[model samples]
Target: MLSSWLLVACGPSQEPPENSSLTLLHPNNPSSDTETYQTENDFDLLVSDYESTQRVIWQKPDLVIAQLGDLSGKTVADIGAGTGYFAFRLVPRAERVIAIDIDQRFINFMDSIKVRLPENVQDRFETRLGKPEDPLLKPSEADVVMLVNTYCFLENRIQYLKTLATGMKNEGELLIIDFKKNNLPVGPPTELKVSTAQVKAELEQAGFKVKKTDNQSLDYQYIIVATLQKPTNKIN
Candidate 1:
């Protein structure tokens, strides 16, 4: 159930003890302001059709890669990595590309795709089935974790991040790319769209230090790069 919680987000009243173990909380449903993820046909259309305005003008997948320079030997966790869109492109440069999605079908599809690739290329990629709150990442492992058009799908946003932080390296970067709230011709309904400022605040509240904000990179969406606050110090 999405209601299951493994950890809680940081706050003046919700601050977790330093020795606490990680937790992931999943709400019974998505937030009222947001729409749910696509099922059957919608999922097919979304992943197969990449020629939409979001891709051509925005050049989204490529644009994100270009901004994060020199991914060689780095580990990238592509959260909500549907159809292995960014995961396939990242494997060549990244030492390990972990493609995470809540959908088993997506993971199955990526697995089938990998079966046809050369042996060397197959070794660089992996697919993980992630839950709404828990991505099931190994603690202190990834170098970079990115979510493209995936942030808003989360129901318990802040608490989810707290658990996600456990899966990353101290200096790891967290990237988020999502639609702007300006009534774009396409994308999730305006009411479901989260503003960049709101996104930044949520991340900061969850202990991420916002490093860069680029609103011009995409015509419809903006990108924010924030590093997880090290435990004094601090995953998927």
Candidate 2:
């Protein structure tokens, strides 16, 4: 279970009008990319916020674990794992959990956490520095690759999905959990939000098929699980 998202600052400033348009500054912009947002370390701040929020909002992490099916011996990858939230949750269940993030600082933090990991999960967790367009994992290396509440920040959805498909095993599953545009006060605004329909369509375009869509969570978010399709042309 991820954070409740209630920690978002809600001051007297009225929620931006429903259709309010705010300019989205791309993270990869050559000129403005180096400009930092908040002074606090982004990854650490995000992790602290999420950990606190989840404690307040979510009742069970088991629900998400169960939805992931069997991970007892699977090689799982958590893409955009800010503070290893999902990665840490999965390490006990998976044979190995590859926690990937675009920030090297986050990876370093994850490495620090590795020392105090439970005996069973001691050597099962590894961190990888990834980019927005590429996950950097070898092809067919994972039984599952998950993007939990992090898909919206991806600069290229189609390329990212394609990279994910290539990184997964033939029967692997990809789980994407994100906030519902209409309900969540946290995360990007509605205009920048990626809808369930948009996610499904994008995955399908990347040659994956929707295996399931579940709204079981009581929060303002949803989950979509998609399976990679067997390639038709084997003889290239």
Candidate 3:
């Protein structure tokens, strides 16, 4: 049964109302409540929602991670890594996992979980507090970058992607998964979502080439795979 707080959180919360539209949850999923994100005070509830088993049925995390292929020597950055849902999971697979987010509460939450990782893999995880305008990734630092359920909320998405592209290695890949713009049984209201077409176009505008678009995988989301374009040599 969903907790009482979960029921109460289905609607937007009081504080940080600006983030009310950032939730990627289905109403059935306890974490689907957007209220938990309104403030750092609800960290505990937010964790429960993010890590809930119900989310796995719809999130299909393993399949999503599979898209990154073998991460033997790759450094993957998970943007908006609330509660390290994908970050901690990638720790054992990738050479390194940088969990980036704008909220310090989520950052601290991930740090708390980091202490419990197996001794060897513990070092593989790092949490970074990012700014609203920038993710603060170093030049060519990531082999693959991911933004799950956090793309639509971006204010200046094109500019953000341009800055994000600078952080990827040459020929690096980017994986984006977000709720489809539809009246789905779960997820935020349809009007608040971004369509796959818009995402693809923005990726192109930001210097990436769309490699694949998968719309049938998740029940309510679409996956976009794009690669950074290589700089062409110009004759002087």
Question: Which tens-of-lDDT digit does each residue in 48-151 have in candidate 2?
Answer: 55555444344245677678987887999999886777789888788999999887777887888888877767778889999878998898999998887678
Off by over 4 Å in 2: 1-6, 9-36, 39-44, 53-56, 118-120, 232-236
Supply candidate 2's per-residue lDDT for 24. 22
Candidate-wise lDDT, in order: 0.71, 0.71, 0.79
Query: For all the candidates, what are their Cα RMSDs to the real structure?
Result: 12.7, 5.8, 5.9
83, model 3: CA deviation in Å? 0.5
TM per prediction:
0.79, 0.81, 0.83
lDDT of 3 by residue, 83-192 (tens): 88899889889999999998888888899889987878878899999987799999999999999978876778999999998889989999999888887655555776
Q: After superposition, which runs of candidate 1 have C-alpha atoms over 4 Å from their true positions?
A: 1-42, 50-54, 233-236
Please report, as a residue range, the 10-residue window in candidate 3 with the lowest summed lDDT.
1-10
Q: 1-236, model 1: which lDDT tens digit per residue?
A: 11101111111123333432221111222432222221222444334333233344454577788777888888899998877777898988888999998878778989999999999889889999998888889988789998887787786888898889999989799989887888664455577678999999999989999999999977778999999867772242
lDDT of 3 at 16: 27
- Candidate 3 deviant stretches above 4 angstroms: 1-41, 232-236
Instruction: Please say which candidate is ahead in lDDT: 1 or 3.
Output: 3
